[model samples]
Target: MKPLKEVAMSYMALSEAQKKLEEGAFGEAAGESSKAMEFSKTMPPGETFDHDGFDALCYAVLASARAGLGEYDACLEASGRALHYFNRRGELQQDEGKQWIAVVFSRGVAFHETGVYDEALKNLNMAGEMITERKGELPGKEAMLKEIERRKSMLLEEEKSQRKPGYKAWWEFWS
Candidate 1:
């Protein structure tokens, strides 16, 4: 069995990676997240230890780093893996709402970058809803809400711009 200190160190590494991601050090964040993931592999998996949440957090940080590096597809893939881990632990919604929000927001940003505006809006809206539902209780709620609103507005503008002006549906074209 791995030492408890090792697992704690892995968590600390993940936190550092998250900080690097927020600081816009994409390459460094990715490297730190990878190191944490390697350490996670050494720990025994169990719900009691929150191994799933740890894995999810690592993937979420990795996704954010990938997005910052403009690797949209890889960002989406990593965010999906993070959500997969989060979903596997159904109880995580109450305890790890913030992590869930991060993963979803990462996916939304990736989708937006990839030109999937609808999916981006859906994910951003979901993240917004999660924040709103947990408002005042969650840390960084205001910042998360602001980011979501900004992304939503951007997506709406892009979607509107993508539409052809004065274009009509087939049925309307006949009229």
Candidate 2:
């Protein structure tokens, strides 16, 4: 088992990272989240308490921070890691609604930043549904849901504009 000091430090780093993220300090948030992830990694595999959710949360923060810093590829990568951890946690038991929502929301943002409109909208929709179902558990639920809807609407418009009518063949003009 990891030392109590390491566990406390990990949580402290995570909280600091979250605060930095909320304050729009992307670089600092990323650093702190990385620290949290590093500490979490030191915990042995198959420990008494599964720390997958904690790892997922750290990755979610990192993803959002990367997105804020315009590191789309890194953001997507971190979001993928977050999703993997979240899935692992889910397989063991039901994940906390807040952690699940955070992971989904970060993934949606990452996808949106990477110009994957379809995936972004899908994730955002999932987050919105989760928020609705877990309304009592999520703080600022209305704002978060509104933001998801806004992103979905924006993606829809962008995707529509990017589409063009296609012809089967250049030679088959008019029959």
Q: Pick the candidate with the highest TM-score.
A: 1
Give the TM-score comparing model 2 with the true structure, all chains together. Answer: 0.78
Model 1 residue runs over 4 Å out of place are: 44-50, 88-95, 137-140, 168-175
Question: What are the per-residue Cα lDDT tens digits for candidate 1 across 1-175?
Answer: 5558678778889989978987889999999998998887776665256666788888888988998899999999999989898767634347566677777888998898888988999999987877777644665677778888898998888777877999777999998
Error of 2 at 71 (Å): 1.8
TM-scores for candidates 1 onward, in order: 0.79, 0.78
The residue pairs that clash in candidate 2, if any, are none
Q: Could you tell me the lDDT of residue 49 within candidate 1?
A: 67
Q: What is the lDDT of residue 10 in candidate 2?
A: 88
Compare the candidates by lDDT and give the number of the best one: 1
Cα lDDT, all candidates: 0.82, 0.79
In candidate 2, stretches whose alpha carbon ends up further than 4 angstroms from where it belongs are 43-49, 91-95, 165-175
Clashing pairs in 1: none
Over the stretch 1-175, how does candidate 2's per-residue lDDT look in tens digits? 5567678888899999989988989999999999997887776665554577787788888887887898878888887888886665542224355756776887787788778888899999988877767635465577788888889989998977776766344567664
